[model samples]
Target: MTMRRHRRLAATLTALVALTAAAGCSSKAKSGDDAGGQGADGVKTGRGVDAKAIQLGVLTDMTGVYATLGKSVTQAQQLYVKQLNAAGGVCGRTVELTIRDHGYDPQKALAGYTELEPKVLGFPQFIGSPFVAAVKQRVDGQDKGLVLPQAWSASLLGSPHIRVIGSTYDIETINAVDFLLKEKGLRKGDKLGHVYFEGDYGENALKGSRYAAEQAGLTVVEQKIKPTDNDMSAQVAALKQAGVKAVVVSAGPRQAASLVGVAAAVKLTVPVIGNNSAFAPQLLATQAGPALERMYYVATPSLPIGADTPVAKKLVADYRAAYPEDALDNGVVAGWSAAQVFGEALKKACADKDLTREGVGKALLTLNAHDAGFGMTHDFSDPQAPSSRQSAIIQPDKSVPGGARVAREPQVSDAAKAFTPGG
Candidate 1:
């Protein structure tokens, strides 16, 4: 990479790392050849710092459509590592995080992977499904470096080496739809409306919603929107004409925000169900109307809006002390969760005598139905092999009587299992 690109990558990576490092640790933290420690189960250390520091490469979208989200997730990774070290480092070795920006471009994703091939582990955030699919073709059926994916949905398919920290797209969507239907007491033949951007992301959202709708015997009035088109007046008009009562939206913030505005303008107020990608407050806040009033979103971690829960409180406090003026977002929360899982895996990997790629894969496969009581839970046990389909559903208040409040606490289905380390 050029010097400028390398510097840019370093800047983004440092931002994430700095977000989670405990006070006094980053400044006095040991660097280079003196940070090594035990691998699994806190075994005895072999070499000193030089042998202990695990090189972890993080590939994220430093600049792209999901750049903000990617950056958040990367920050979470930073926090995880920082905490791990503060608590005596992972397996007695400090984790050295090296971040590379893929720009949300597929070719760049490939390039990023190639550049990071020499690292001990790869923790990629916001590679998205398309980039994952491309990488999967190359990594599957091959035993090489571990690819810890931060993207959900598409990343679940193919690739044995790339372990996921969240549930599959289909499962998340199906669960969300099911929750909405059951909670609202909706029966079969209920009319529903679907609005989404005409792309892979939107299509994936549609797939989950459709599956749930079919199970509940619901009918959908589907409308597609171009990413460039912001005004959803006509789409709302069509849905209103169809007499749709509930609407499921799967699009970006800009387009989804527009839909919310139009929905209220046309007086199609009922329940607005959205996929995980559409859960940003600013997105709905972009346009006026009651779009977010009863907006229901399906997400895993229920991060308190303003540092309420134990984890959120600690996150806010530590981050403030650490990063100070930096802001936290949903993506960062996801990243933190991902790192939690990876930390567990690393602990396990170091414990096992055979700490190869296959060994780590096996350990992760065994991590089914683990719950992080801080907020969310997951269950990845499958008939086949290791799966990353462990996530829960959370609903955030779009419009509280007084600004955005915690509408609903994070809730996981009975299917989610508690994490049992070395199980």
Candidate 2:
């Protein structure tokens, strides 16, 4: 009786101990799963966001024709994220930024997007219009992430998931025409020349120029150029022969310099205006620097970084402190402003603790008349409308921080308001 009873008791005790340990493991697993399922604000999250941080991507051109601008963009984005993290990031979660260079190539941009699609919540800056167009469908359809593209084309106005921070190229060109006609005293039937790249950004600006020319009773002489073209001498010579009273350019810095420099050489003393992307601070260091200074006006969505505003001052100080070796440029301001817009949207998305891609998209659509202290306001309330039609005219001045000074305050021309997208 002693041996049999002792053996049965020992076996029962061992079985009970095993059952207790299994129950404890099951309970711990349940707790861990619950925490992982919820965000910091106790709401369910989507891709690129977790309880501790939200990850975003930046698609830019670091080794292309726009490399200087791209580098500034990357730097400003980093600075903005750093400041945001220091001030307690969105929804109590640290913000992580992943930057990928696309070299201003559509294929490279697509590849970068493919790689970043699964890792980031959204893209704060997609640098090129052509690149954005190449990946728009994938980004808007399957990826389901919000994208704020650096390209401001009217053609992009209808996308549900894309947010534009400033005026479209079309509207900016209309303003340029207005400034040239009214302020610069160009008469009716005068020939206005336009030299542009053969892509969305350039085409959109060209459309605006054409519309404005018609309205002002002026003739338009157009020359379509490619991104790779470095010599615009022939184009300038043709415009000069056509007796153009003014010229509007929609190209990058290299082409801009070439066009203006050649125009000056050929004794084409007409006023030259450019879209925002056409001017970079580095242009002043080229032989075209004198030509740019002779008569060049640039249409911009924001005041120059040299503007005497509190926000501009803060941006300059922070940018210089962060990159003392780099000169402050409009691209840095643009990048910083884009990040600010994204941060605001993130804050809105966190208001209800819904930090998913859908939440961020809705927040972006609700942003109405957001003033970044850049002397212009952006309204995202109407999805069918372009972000902002207002723009300021700037003339090149080497003394300025960004190599430009405000020539005209922010204004929305009647022609810009009446212009149609994709027309």
Candidate 3:
């Protein structure tokens, strides 16, 4: 062979290498296009989702009964979205959060939902039980978007469109009753007082109390009130006269403070356990702070802030950095946890390149024992089963970030397991 023959062979090899490189580049580009492509039905993927960003809605109370709790929830959602965006976002799109204050009003929540439904992919903070109840039908039937409701009522657990972050209020109350009987040495025949509102939130809690009472062979003295009622003196006096051993309250923070203060004034020295909605930092600053310190216990779905976990530590630090003037509130932690679950669902939906409302709903239904951080886990595999049944009992302590100290770790009690929403 001569030098000319060697030159021809080298040219052939160079041409083959160039052709192979072109094919590789084309395959990579096609994969990227497929990820960002339309669904099989040729419909747009998701509402409020585009090439640049995905928008989420928040309907919370900023100036109503649970103002502090609602505001903290909004802030926590913002912080989570910010962190997610900084970490390159989900499916290569930034997360944009839009918040609206319903002021704990059902009408206002309905209006806000109508306004935001067209613009957001989903809701991370659907605040009030009443509000969610008011709009549940429309949301489920018409809007058809995924919603992470702040209220964990048993009634809403059956809705396919709503995602609950923690244990239902009824389950929380059941665990609270169990905690009192086991930890506080309350006897089987002791009279337990139940002070609750009149709606589903209150009624659901009452159901749990009744179930636990039946199991423990205790008597429950009931005192029902409206959310508009500010004074609980008469209710407390009734419980005091009945010689109740312990009380379970399912009301707002103001009502909680009122009940505690009135109980202290009447010399009713008994443990006052409330549902998760009953505790807030503002209660610690009110005149009932001392009474809350003495008798207040809250049963919640997640670990208190400052728990020894990577997720908890990061949440505390991020919350403090984002809002320096505000203390760490469990409402915020709850909001962050909701966002985490929503993010997981979003990732799952995107995996199939179909980020529609139906896709998100399907993804949520497939979740099995998903750890939502802060020592909480959820199983959505069965639509009929409650989202979460684990709860922890905490007592008010002004020193902790969430203004409560964990008296018990999260556990799934038999009472919770036996809980049937409206049963």
Model 1 is weakest, by summed lDDT over 10 consecutive residues, at: 414-423
lDDT assessment of candidate 2: 0.83
lDDT of each: 0.57, 0.83, 0.81
lDDT of 1 at 15: 43
lDDT of 3 by residue, 30-144 (tens): 3111333464544346567777778889999999988888888889989888888889887788989988998976556666776777777889889887667655665665567
Error of 3 at 259 (Å): 1.2
Candidate 1: residue 406 Cα off by (Å): 5.3
> Which residue pairs clash in candidate 3?
none
Can you rank all candidates by TM-score, best first? 2, 3, 1
Candidate 2 residue pairs in clash (backbone atoms < 3 Å) = none
lDDT of 1 by residue, 254-330 (tens): 55666767777677775666666665555534555345655555444334335356776666566556666555556
Ranking by lDDT: 2, 3, 1
How far is 43's C-alpha from truth in model 1 (Å)? 9.2
What would the C-alpha RMSD of candidate 3 be, to one decimal place? Answer: 18.7
